[model samples]
Target: MTASDARRPVQLEIAVQDAAGARIAFEAGADRVELCQALAETGGLTPSAGAVEAVLAVAGRAERLAVLVRPRPGGYVYDADEIAVVAADVREVVRRGAGAVVVGALDAAGGIDTEALSRWIDAAAGAEVVFHRAIDTLSAPVDAIDQLVALGIRRVLTSGGATRSIDGLGTVEALVRGSAGRVQIMPGGGVRVEDVPAFVSSGADAVHLSARRSSGDTAPSGPGGGASGFDVTDGAIVAAARAALDEATSGS
Candidate 1:
């Protein structure tokens, strides 16, 4: 067979949070993992030394670990202090050997701050860049895509700026076409085991989601527990997502 036939497609990366979660996903066959803290908060950034170290220990097996680089969950725009924090964060994460960096910045009208983003991408020093769902906040996603392309971002994680990807298929498809090999379009948000097919059918270059199971039908004890908007990820969910990926790849 030709070398091209042996080569796989770009990547099938899954967003994940912890070392245990990463191990489960890697074992279940996820190609890569995005390390973050408050996945409930749309997968906010975590630059903790211990967490980064934990993730790095598994870097040998994981396809990659792209750490989310936001200082807060409120918005993409950042004050001077937050920017400094993110700057320092880039240095530390790269020093810790993260495989990629997921981040973004936007103006009040929701347009991407190409300058701010470019600065971070440079600060990241050649590590892959995944513009997070902040793309969802933009008033005109197409415009944002064009802007990001000019900035030379690696990929964008978005659900077509909607509540979930299924609701934004048309726009997502348009984005995939608009990207036209310039960058990757990774769909995310509200993606579950059963809904993965819908994302595949929509022409996503790749998919992203939080996959996990509850301890029980019973809820958690309180706010510090499951009541939080972003529940922690689980190995079972990662396995299911892998199964879905296998089905999608095999055309089942």
Candidate 2:
């Protein structure tokens, strides 16, 4: 870590699905909000331009807005058409006043798809570009950090090759040591409020989570008429995470 980075407090980035979530994150004192759609269904696909505008309106002059640019809900690998669609989406989102764009693409060999990344970066038109958790799908996540840094990626959100950031603490720490302040390393995916301290101590630049709670309102659906609830950003959880991050990074 650089001297400046060391003195800076760890950041909290919340993955939000809508304007309400963005408002909650802002009110809870989060450093940034990653806006996406179908978060509960598809692990976060790209949100609509209207959605981005609404969130930006809510974000206003406070929170930083980073829009997720995943074109579809499957793996990171994408065909030419999908890549083009992703690039277009990136352009649209950046045009809509997003401060950053979150994206990920992998080659069939399970490595970074530099080709697709270049297109998306070009489409970003100098807006901050963040590599999402798809880095965890690589065999050499630590090594991929070097590649992303080389590609001018501003930050990478990863779980250190594990499904949960807590389980991947070792790899996360290793990535931090290897980053050398060139690119930001953020541990995300299954991050809980109680795990904030451990991540803060890992020397990560930031921590990402979806401090979400189900809105217990059920709807009458076909087939399986089970009581299904939708997920929303929980203000209480965001506050707790903000407090935990503050307490953990206090003595720095």
Candidate 3:
């Protein structure tokens, strides 16, 4: 690593589904927050306009927040109409004070959708563009890093093509080395506080996690009797992760 890069502290990014989660993340000392909606149901999807406004209010700075632009919960392969919707959502979120937009799309061949990516970049109108975990779906994700860099993407959130970031540490390290400071490689997906040191030692620019805990009524009710309770960001988890990252990167 370059001398300057070695001195750069690792960032801690928390994924949140609402304003309240944003507040928790902020208070926990998060470097940035990725705001979304329906995280429990769909992993994450584009939040409503009001949701964006609320999160921005708590973030206090646009660059402290990034909003996911996924139009649906399903696969990243999008139809024309879905692409149009994504474009509109990107513009809307950016206009609403999102400093960065997390987005990804795949072609039928299971590769990055350059066309859709270009459209989203244009719609962002200067806001940072982040390529989400869709890169993990590729057979050779390391090779795709260069493609993303060429596309002017500022960052990429990934689990190194594995279900959990910890299990994919080797691949994550390769991705970090392969990026060569061109694009930020953030290890995400099932990342735990215990895993922070490993990722930090890998030279990752940042680490991302939902850090959520569930609450609410578990009594049988509603259509499927599914738990009526919901998940919220756990401040304790965020704070623990923050401490771990700081400890790991200390004197590096």
Compared with the true structure, all predictions reach lDDT values of 0.73, 0.89, 0.91
Predictions: Cα RMSD each? 4.0, 2.5, 1.9
Model 1 ranges with Cα > 4 A deviation: 1-11, 41-43, 61-63, 215-232
For residue 164, model 1's alpha carbon misses the true position, in angstroms, by 1.7
With a 3 Å backbone cut-off (N, CA, C), the pairs that clash in candidate 3 are: none
lDDT of candidate 3 over 1-252, digit per residue (tens): 345444468999999999999999989989999999888788899899999999999999999999999988988999999999999999999999999999999999998999999999999999999999998889999999888988889999999888898998999999998999999999999999999988888889999999999866475657865656789999999999999888777745
What lDDT tens digits, residue by residue, belong to model 1 across residues 1-252? 223222224345666667777777777677788888866644566657788779779767323788888887677877677777887887788777886888888866667777777778888888878888888877668666777888879898988878877788778878887887788888887777776666665556677876755434454558666452334557677778777766665554
Q: Looking at model 3, how many pairs of residues clash?
A: 0
Output the better candidate (1/2) by lDDT. 2
The per-residue C-alpha lDDT of model 3 at residue 18 equals 91
Candidate 3: regions farther than 4 A off: 1-7, 219-225
Model 1 TM-score, all chains together: 0.85
Ranking according to TM-score, highest score first: 3, 2, 1
Best by lDDT: 3
Residue 74, model 2, lDDT: 84
Between candidates 1 and 3, name the one with more favorable lDDT: 3
Clashing pairs in 2: none
Ranking by lDDT: 3, 2, 1
